[model samples]
Target chain A: MVVYGVALLAACYLIGVIAGDALGALIGVQANVGGVGIAMLLLLLVSNSTSIKLQLGEATASGITFWSAMYIPIVIAMAAKQNVVAAVSSGWMAVVAGTLAVLVSFALIPVLSRLGRGAPKV
Target chain B: MALDTLFDSLVELLARNGLITAFLFVGLVLALSNWLSKVVTRGQVHGSAVAIAAGLVLAYFGGVATGGSKGLADVGLFAGVGLLGGAMFRDFAIVATAYGADLGALRQAGWVGALSVVIGVVLSFVVGAAVAVAFGFTDPIAVTTIGAGAATYIVGPVTGTALGASSDVVALSVAAGLTKSILVMIGTPLVAKRIGLDNAHSALIYGGLMGTTSGVAAGLAATDPKLVPYGAMTATFYTGVGCLLGPSVLYFLVAAIL
Candidate 1:
């Protein structure tokens, strides 16, 4: 069963490559759309657990990472498609956004936690 | 007659360049995402980081080799695809187990998995948006960036889920680690040019959006909703600070290297 699943995943990867090539041509960017498809296939594989009742905590974390990652390009492409933004420029914007993210995360994470501690129970 | 002709030509251009081709790509990618999640995870362990890592790394290399440029969007897309594929593996196993007439445990695992992601995205989006406004940022890009970061802080489990599928977990984590660096290296500049947000305000707005999404993801993964609101707030605030400080720091680092 496991082998079959892996084989199925590989097949999907091949299809993804084909799709990515097509998408890449459409976007005219030096990027591969197929990789995204393949990666999604891999995510679905890891998140599943059988009767073993795999730890909920672990699985959820894994899911979040994959889902967010998946959306990045889609968002970029969507933004590009809408003409809200272009694909090439997104890189720099992401840097500014990322830097802001790190600093803000560091500063506010603790303060927020403390405030929550003092706040009335909901 | 010329004006009418020009208008018709423009409409055709828009239809050809923007709509049909782009959506076809989106559909292909989305369908691929769904299927990838299902196929790769047919029968794999749920919580093993190593297993997840193996799958992600393979995907990453595959992506890089195929595409030639491992830029911001590529990494983000890859990480998302990796995580989904990994998670789907776990989900399917449980469903398969239930197939043999065992439905008891499926409820908690499946529901929890779905709930965590759904709530994380929806709630984080709301909180991030509100905070972005509170911070006096009106740009949509900034808003989305903040929301995405905020989603990171909701729970550790969710964070793990995010990382589990990505080949470079640190790179994808909260958009602050290696992942953000790559993105900033590529995504930040591109977006800045496209939107004409070349000033400090652009920096702040962009930072806020990115930070919010990262924070929300972590908060949700940690399994603490109380942190969600706080995560959004901190993300917004710190993003502002980063906006103010990033340029100077970046310059100094660059200068020293040069």
Candidate 2:
């Protein structure tokens, strides 16, 4: 049944990739565009908005869940490994951005912690 | 002669083409990192962090050894890494993520929860873009891609791929996200007491503040297992919000600024 879901994903990607190309051309970016993201959104809308009764099996349900959870990590790890080699030479800009982002976010912890009500404001 | 050379021939084939070899290499790296985490840091540092660091070191050597465009790809045996790490698989993984999420919790998070996701995405993106500018990356694409990355690992690549940003920029985005994730995982427990991270409401806020889903989940697990569900609930929104704003509002904002 995971295949059932993948069938849906494939359709979304096909639409998404084409839309990405068209959007890229319009914007003049000439890239992969938001095909990946678009597909995700399309899938999200379909899954969330409608309650399709697939009556999936336990194994299939697990399979789909596994893919959903592990998707980003597996793909990013693979992509990052190949790209890290090139990124090193792209200069330290990427490194700098990453380090600075972490630092800034860390700094905001105290302020952000104050946002929600916590333990009677004590 | 045939019998003697059989093993040599097999090894040669494996080394010559990297498709399967790349999978092996990834697996081996993961195993090594898990081992390091267990024995060295005693799990204080996650295996994921260890693997990323090790991969970077290997990539540097691969670049030095080969002087090629792709680090490990320079080695004939590791060529499979290229195909394994390509966009096709990345997109596939991304598209599949939507299936598992339950959006019912968003309503439960109410207004504060929603606000947190939005603020988290914007703050992270702004910080990433600022650093990109400081580093002289004037191009909007690079800035937006990196900014998206700062939002979350998933958002970074999706944004990078969408904007036609270079692979290096995408890689940087991933690095930024990974660092944030590792920090969140380690820091959450230490700061739990001070921040009053003791309830579902606090966990939700924490998740929104730290948008990395895996990081939030792991950190909450360490701090308080009961908080995991709450934190994860909002962290999902962080990814959703990041993905939504990354290529649209954030990209345009970066473009206008630079």
Candidate 3:
């Protein structure tokens, strides 16, 4: 039963990758398009549409939920890893921009916070 | 199965491929960070915050060890990390998270929420471009690439590749975006109280201001999971806006200035 759930995810992922790549090709970029987003959307559509028609068992449903929740931490870690690598080899300017963005956001917080308080309903 | 059990199975598969190894590394990092957060920060800090820091440190070592473009890919066992963490999954995560967002909540954030996304993207671009100039990057492509990267990691590379900027410049932009994401993740919880980042409404504004979806989502998850969708909803648009502006209006402005 859970096998059916994972199969759904795997199919979505495959379609997502293809769709993303096609979009990238259309846009003239050489990378994968919104594969993850496409996959998630596909999953959402399939799960929602199939719920009424198909009797997805508890084990199957839980499998889908488990993978969905895991998406964030896993992706972020991978992205962070790539980012760290790019920053290290890209020379000082890249490092500077990265470092400076963090510093600037920190400094901007107080100013933005005050500006955001125009209508504090709470 | 429970999360602990999931991690148990995941860690054993680390050597299987890039995706599995990537998952293993992330799980290990989260576990370690959660432990640190509880023991050291007394739970003041979020586990994702610590995990990102640990991830970056390991990434650095991976790059050093393999001398490869992809940090973990340089190492044999971690090579699949390149695919696991690539744009496809990144965009999918964003899309999936955004789908969970409710459109009705947009009213709570109001016009201020809308304005923040625009202001945040432009402001970040300006800051990034200024840094590029200060560092003696006189070329428009380099400046624009870096500036776009400041907007969001996704926007940065997209703009760079579109404008024919060198790989190095594009890479820098991604780094710039990543740094912002990491900072947002770690800083949100600490500043949530002071900035009124508690409600669904305020979370939208916070997301608009931050703009990086992953950063805002992780940060909001740390601050309050209920607000993640709200913040991420607007944050998604921030990326779209950044993509629109990065290669066109912003690039022209930087070119003129340079």
Winning candidate number (lDDT): 3
| Model 3: CAPRI class | acceptable
- State TM-scores per candidate: 0.26, 0.58, 0.71
Task: Tell me the spans in candidate 2 whose CA falls farther than 4 Å from its real position.
Answer: A16-35, A45-51, A69-98, A106-122, B1-12, B15-17, B106-258
Cα RMSD of all models vs. native, in order, equals 20.0, 7.2, 6.8
lDDT of 3 at B151: 77
lDDT of candidate 2 over A1-122, digit per residue (tens): 66765666678778877886776566654343445546655665676654553555565555546555544334324433443444445456655655565456555555555654442332
For A9-105, candidate 1 gives per-residue lDDT tens digits of 3444445455655665574433343233233333344445542225334444443434333332233232221111121233433334335433443
The local lDDT score (0 to 100) that residue A61 gets in candidate 1 is 45
**What are the runs in model 3 whose C-alpha is more than 4 Å off?**
A1-64, A88-92, A103-122, B1-14, B17-25, B80-84, B90-103, B110-114, B164-168, B221-223
Ordering by lDDT: 3, 2, 1
- Model 3 lDDT tens row, B1-258: 699998866654665656776677667767888999999999877776677566657777877877665665556666666666664565444444433344445554557777877888888898899998898889999999999898788889989988999987887888888777766766777778876777766777677778887677667766776676567656755776677678888988988877
Worst 10 residues of 2 chain A by lDDT: A71-80
How does each model score on lDDT? 0.33, 0.65, 0.69
Q: Model 1, B1-258: lDDT tens per residue?
A: 999999888656644454344344445654554455457655231112112222234434544445533321243323333222332332222122111221222222232222222332334334533454455645443443443443332221133332232322222223322333233323332343343333222222332334433322222212222222222221323322222222233223323533
What DockQ does every candidate get?
0.04, 0.28, 0.28
Error of 3 at A54 (Å): 13
lDDT of 2 by residue, B51-77 (tens): 655654665677778877555656767
lDDT by residue for model 3 over A47-95, one digit each (tens)?
A: 5665532776788866565655765575456544454555655677766
